[model samples]
Target: MSRFHLGLIINPLAGLGGPAGFKGSDGVAQQALALGIEPKAAARTRTALECLLPIKQGLHFLTFPGPMGADLLAEMGFAHQVLGQVHEGPSSAADTREAVEALQQAGVALILFAGGDGTARDICSAVREGQPVLGIPAGVKIQSGVYAINPRAAGELTRRLIEGGLVRLASGEVRDIDEAALREGKVTARWYGELTVPEEGGYLQQVKQGGVESEELVLADLAAWLESNWESDVRYVFGPGSTLHGLAENLGLQTTLLGVDVIENGEVIAHDVSEAQLFELVDGHPARLLVTAIGGQGHIIGRGNQQISPRVLRAIGLGNLRVVATKRKLATLEGRPLLVDSGDVQLDDAFPDVVRVWAGYKEELLYPVGK
Candidate 1:
């Protein structure tokens, strides 16, 4: 029997900016590092690769050297060949593109990469139109549809492919946000291109929907309800998204549209805070997490809001979470359960099977939650 040849790429600095409150990890990696932000891309890639260990004997990996791919593979004792060398310093976008080109030439069956949307754009630029690729969700700006819901899901999909299970291919859009605009409190996402990815509706995340919600009255009503229910002693941690931003506007509070903010007693205490800052503020305090699902993705946790880290969630507690989304946005999911990929497997597993979503004025819908 022939071994499955898999190509691997890891963007070592992919997610450093997320927890550091840099919005996106494009050109500010060094600054984030200066702030002592630890990189998690390699760790996340390891989680994905761990799922393939059972079939290690039947697999052969082709990847770039060091932190790009070979380091983690070597640590895991996978049978892999190093394909190229990364530049001496921190790996740049050029390194990712060069690695993709080399992997294409190697005729590998699939290219599994760990990065955010920017890395997806790099892969799209260097590969042939139909070349197969899969993304492990390990980057800050994961607005692209190419990534698996989480690292474990990426490996599960790869395992099925290697075992010759019936899998279908589909085109996923490669989208990215302008980090400059994102930092300026403006979101401008443009479609770069598309990549052929292994399709399993349950495994792959849907493209993030970008636009204004059509149901203006519904949002206003939801915001009103939240305002009426505000507790003076409870700190409100607002997660990012247009839906929550609308809620903030209702309260006449300036908030970061793409970053987490903390409010207490009807005042914005912190704006665009990092995970560490958030943990410090909410720990041992009465806090309610006010978050909304990604429009089309149905992810109430861990899509783009990394500031709401596991410790932050522990501080806020699951019972204090208030999910707000318009019914129209919920319909885009087509009855799929909301997803939570908080990076802590046990924490994600502890989430209840169902959650209550505040849909409108004094209205709540019992929605299902999934890992």
Candidate 2:
């Protein structure tokens, strides 16, 4: 009969560094702003909160002041109590910890934060073992497994939590890497502490697995087939990851290992192109998107390669899309469907059935793709 109390926190600068080409959004907010990059945490948080609006009557919100949290809830017509103050400048890690401590002291049932792994680490540092915390992924390079597959999924999980339908609260991984080294093309992710999260089968994300042994032979065979069938005049957009990087290497082309690249006539045309550049490139030319799913996560879009925006996907057309992954990588998914979060809900709903994935030379597997 009592009301459900949910604590909320938002790191306004969580995703500002992503599109600005910074490896992570940690201490690079000012630099990203100087480069004309706007913060996305607020918008992303709104998307999640909007999904929870249907059940607003039964829930009472506890959140931080201003843009840090309460503003979005208030704007959405939800009842909430504001916690500690955040000064006019950027919100620091200390502010997040203070908010968490205050929310815990207020006896909230759960805490929902909008940020990246850094924000997750802050929650882990502040909350006790049984304190429930969930993440609404609003950052670049989401190497951790604590986040939902997308903002909508996060909202769905929260809805179940508030309705008392969420029966499982499992410990999910909290991982992060050195942004400085990651920017230098060196990927070294370290495991941090775990946090209690609401879990729903096939809806929540699984922990991201570490690098697997290279599937060189299968990748080489796939590359050989690609080279032979590649259209002479068509442009191919290669998404990030080692799989696509291997394909680039097979063609003797240099690619930004962790950034999107464009190949045409067996040459690198646009190296590390942005979303706008991708839109321009695919305007008139026959283009195809060659992307691979993230291991364990099974996300073909919206993980690290945000440059391949939904607009870019529409330009290439779904028929022009080609997915490539090793058999070993597919095995890690363990029957979970491949996922997508292109930031367009309509676009995400367009493909609800299975899509063919190129697993090897003349090899194909029909994997389910969903939002």
Candidate 3:
């Protein structure tokens, strides 16, 4: 049997800017590094690659040299062929594009890359139309639809493809936001292009839905319900999204629109906190995590809320999680279960199969949850 050829690429600085309040990592990796922000692209890529370990003997890996790809593969003991070289410093967008082009020329079965929208844009610019590619969600500005629901999902889907499972090919939109505008509290998302990706609705994330929730009354009701149910001394961690932002406004709490915030005793205590800070705040305290599904993606965790790390989730406990979304948003999922990719497989698996979603005032719907 012929071994399947797999191409791997990792953008080393892909997510450095997210927790550092730089909005995106396109050109601010150095600044983020200077501010002590650690990059997580390699760690996230490792999670995706772990699923393929069982079939390593039947696969041939091709990747760029050094931090871009080969370093992690070597550390994990995956035998792979290095295709290109990295210069003296951090890999740039050109390196990513060059890696994609080289991988295409090598005629690999699929190219698996780890990065945010900027990296997706690089791949889109270099890959030929209809070529198969998949993304591991390792970046901060994950506005594009190319990424899997999480790192593990990416590995699982790749494994399925190598194992001859029924995986269809579909076009995923490549969208990006203006980081400068995003820093100024403005989200300017534009559709750059699309890439062909492995399609398994349960494994892949949909294009992030833009615009405000059309039903104003539903948000008002959600806010009222949350306010009425506020528990004294219980810290409430608010994940990012339009729904949560609107709810914060309704409750007259000043919360960051696209960053994690904490509420205690009906007052905002921490705004735009990182994973370390969140774990510190919620560690020995009773906390409830309030998160809403991404409008069209059906993801309640690990899409854009990486700040709510696994340890933080463990500290808060899974049972204390409160999911809020309009019925219309849930309808967009077309009956697919709400997904969670907390980066910790055990914790992701620990969530109950069924969850209660707060849709309106005193109204809750039993929804299915998936990993």
**Model 3 C-alpha lDDT per residue in residues 128-228, reported as the tens digit of each score:** 97578899999887989999999999999887665533345667999999998888999899999999887663322322353344557878887888889
In order of appearance, the predictions have TM-scores of: 0.55, 0.54, 0.55
Clashing pairs in 1: none
**Model 1: how far is 98 from its true place, Å?**
0.6
Q: 360 in model 2: Cα distance from truth in Å?
A: 41
Write model 2 residue lDDT over 75-137, tens digit each, in one string: 999989998788768789999999999998886766889999888888888888757778999
Model 1, residue 191: C-alpha shift (Å)? 0.6
The alpha-carbon root-mean-square deviation between model 1 and the true structure, to one decimal in Å, is: 21.7
Clashing pairs in 2: none
Clashes of 1: 0
Residue-pair clashes per candidate, as listed? 0, 0, 0
Q: Model 1 over residues 86-149: C-alpha lDDT tens digits? A: 8889999999999999998876778999999999999999999767789999988888999999
Off by over 4 Å in 2: 201-371
Which pairs of residues collide in candidate 3? none
Q: Candidates ranked by lDDT, best first?
A: 3, 1, 2
Model 2 — TM-score against the truth? 0.54
